[model samples]
Target chain A: MNMIEAAAVHVRFGDRVVLESVDLAVAEGEFHGVMGPNGAGKTTFFNVLTGRVKPNRGRVLLAGEDVTGLSPHRIAAKGIARSFQIMTLFDEFSALDNVMMGLPEFRARSHDVARAAAGDSRFAAKSSEALAAVGLADKGDIRAKDLSYGDRRALEIAVALAQAPRVLCLDEPTSGLGSDGVQRLAALIARLKGRLTIVAIEHDMEFLFSLADRISVIHWGQVVARGTPHELQQNEWVRRSNLGKFA
Target chain B: MAAPLLVLDDVRKVYTRGRVIRRPTFTLQANLSLDEPDIVGVVGPNGAGKTTLFEMMTGSNAPTSGRVLVAGTDIHGVKYRERDRLAIHYHQSYQVRRFRKRIPSAFLAPSPTRTPLVHLFDEPQFNLQDGYIGFMLDFFRKLRDEGRLVVLCMHPTAAWHLDILAEIAGRFLFVAGGGVTAVANFGALVADPRCRSYLGPEMTKAADAICHGAVHSST
Candidate 1:
């Protein structure tokens, strides 16, 4: 069954049409990639899916339930966790503390889970596991503020992963990292491939091609093409419209 | 070389929990200097004292030992008004609560207008949206364009703002449990195409180390 489905969705930002009759679906354990240019409304689509923004029309279903107008936190509680394209993190707190905040649901799951794991043991175990998965286990304790630009982007993914969501949505996960950082993040996502449903919006064609099982191209707020990576690489319209320069 | 924009000399912080006390000392013995714009990443474990280092540098909290100097001025020993003029510390959380309560009252009070030279941001990404994010980006951009230094205490996730941040400060330091491990020039890490993906593992490790170090060191 599809974890998330958006059908005939329309969204506007003060009359600027961001999405029009959009249809998208994320199946369980599927890694779907959303590709587009800067103003293509990739982030807006994510916002709509996660209930951060309300769509003017159409219905959004999460696990077969209508969740079009729910709040972001509520959607997150329903098993959708997102990492910002612009990178969002708690600066003053240590990286571990930031990761701990992502586990509010898990923290609420048990009382002893909070007090007994206040130190770096349980939190470290889970946070470090997520960090190590992303190749950031070594820097877990460093203040989020102290990381390099690239490292910060990776840390955001780690924070999202710590939430242990059923559906993980990432916006521009590799916007500001080096080659090594990109490879590591790709590998990290690859590791999570079969375990979680992922919807990634990216401008980096190479990264998307490497990680995405299915690629959907959005242009001017519409899905111009949807196919396997091979199919996308061979699509003439996709090449002309979005992949022309990159391909 | 010119003196560092900020310097920490024999900085020490000791926290006591009940009857237990733990004190960690950090030293920057070598002359650390920033002659031009650069982006530096400080990488270490949690307890390595990154926040404490920032507190000492921004003059929010005093070091048990040593001194923090900004622009060659001793911040801890300086008068309150003088310190306010030199730097402003931005907490991780906007403390919307405090802003709602204190800022307006302070503004209405007979306090002198404060324009901080260094804008310290703890978690700059916390509760940030399009408008506020744009405001912060523009604010720092103006400072950077005008050649001012802004120190950011940010998480790895929010590091995407580093490009704009570097445009302003041009230099960065990565502080972890072990102290400043990596210092890079401006656009050094961001300019690379692959740096974005590689960040995941590096940040995870650095954060892990700091948290582990902090907990153990504190205990």
Candidate 2:
């Protein structure tokens, strides 16, 4: 069954139409990638899915329920979670505290950070489970500020996992990561795939191709192509869009 | 020898959020100098301080230690208005309006009346369309023609721009963990472990990936 779907989505800012009649569908437990050239309204599509940017007209369905036009907080409550291109963690907090802050119960989860709690066993257990899921099991005590860049990103995902989201959205999760970092993240995503419906916007086509079961290419704010990795590679427009660079 | 047009003498920037919660901290630790009008490709993974370098150059954030020099004058010592005129940082969005009316002066030629200037652009690939990418590349070349220094900062995602810049960019400055490491050209860049290791697979490949239009340019 399609866990998430967008129908005829249209989003615009003033005279600029960022997203035009965009449609996307993701099956349950599927890893979906979004690829586009720069300024293709890819970011807007991301925002629309996360409920951060409400489409001027359209419908967003999360598990067959209407989620369009909802605030990011409401969407998070609906089991949708997102990590940012920029680190949104409270730098001063410990890894455990950071993950705890990502729980839906821990204040809305709109990248609006909640104060880190010193010792809450209940939150600690939940956050620990999350940290372990992302392989940061022993690093929970380390401050978010002190974690290595790769670990910090993992912690961010752990935070999202703590929410127990059905659908997790990663915005350029590997943008700043090194080769080792990229491999580490790819491994984490690989392990998490069957358990979560994952949607990612990635510029690194290699990472996207290796991890995404299916991908949809957005151009001019519309999804011009959607198919398996092999199909996308065969696409003329995707090829001309410099898909060769990634190869 | 005339001093370099730009210099960072052990520059550092620190942040202190709360007295009890967080102590003082430093994010940027830059120590480098550049003299030529080389088209320097500023690249690193995210959080590598590529943007911070531009910020320090534009005088938006004052470094906690050391100095930033443009034409031998300390940018930190000058008022923001003066720094604004000297250091122009162009982000990807037109809404920024910070450096609106920005042109390719450095790539081509300066106004002749103004002092020799440096234009710092962070991720100029944003919002660009299909045909316009080449246009922007040509514009930067024009700036180079005019005898201005251009620092083109690109995130790994936009590393494809490196292929285009490589043909013209005389140097590649790899920023990792806030420090600066410079390579002579694209040949040295891909060969250096720093460039390959720091960038993701696509960007690493792009370090040597030549734009089709300029296949012989040697990325």
The candidate maximizing lDDT is: 2
In the range B1-219, model 1's lDDT, one tens digit per residue, is 555556666666654444455433444322244433222333233555666666666655666567776666777655543354455554433331111122232333221223344545555552222112333444455555555465655545533343234334445565543445334654444333333343476544433444243221110
TM-score of each: 0.50, 0.53
lDDT of 2 at A169: 94
Q: What are the DockQ scores of the candidates, in order?
A: 0.01, 0.02
- Model 1, span A1-247: residue lDDT tens: 9988899788866424567557898889999999764566788899999888999888999889998989988888888889997778988766776777677555565556445446546766788877787777788878899988877887888888888888999988888778888887888888899899999988777788767889777654657567777676553323433343344
In candidate 1, stretches whose alpha carbon ends up further than 4 angstroms from where it belongs are: A106-121, A237-247, B1-219
Candidate 1 vs. true structure, TM-score: 0.50
Mind giving the per-residue lDDT tens digits that candidate 2 earns over B131-165?
23443454456556666677887665565455556
Tens digits of per-residue lDDT, candidate 2, A37-86, equal 67878888889988889888899999999999899989998999989888
Superposed by TM-score, candidate 2 places the C-alpha of residue A140 at a distance from the truth, in angstroms, of 0.8
Error of 2 at A211 (Å): 1.0
Q: Please, what is the whole-model Cα lDDT of each candidate in the order they appear?
A: 0.63, 0.74
On the 0 to 100 scale, the lDDT of residue B16 in model 1 is: 45
Error at A243, model 1, angstroms: 4.4
> Fraction of true contacts reproduced, model 1?
0.00
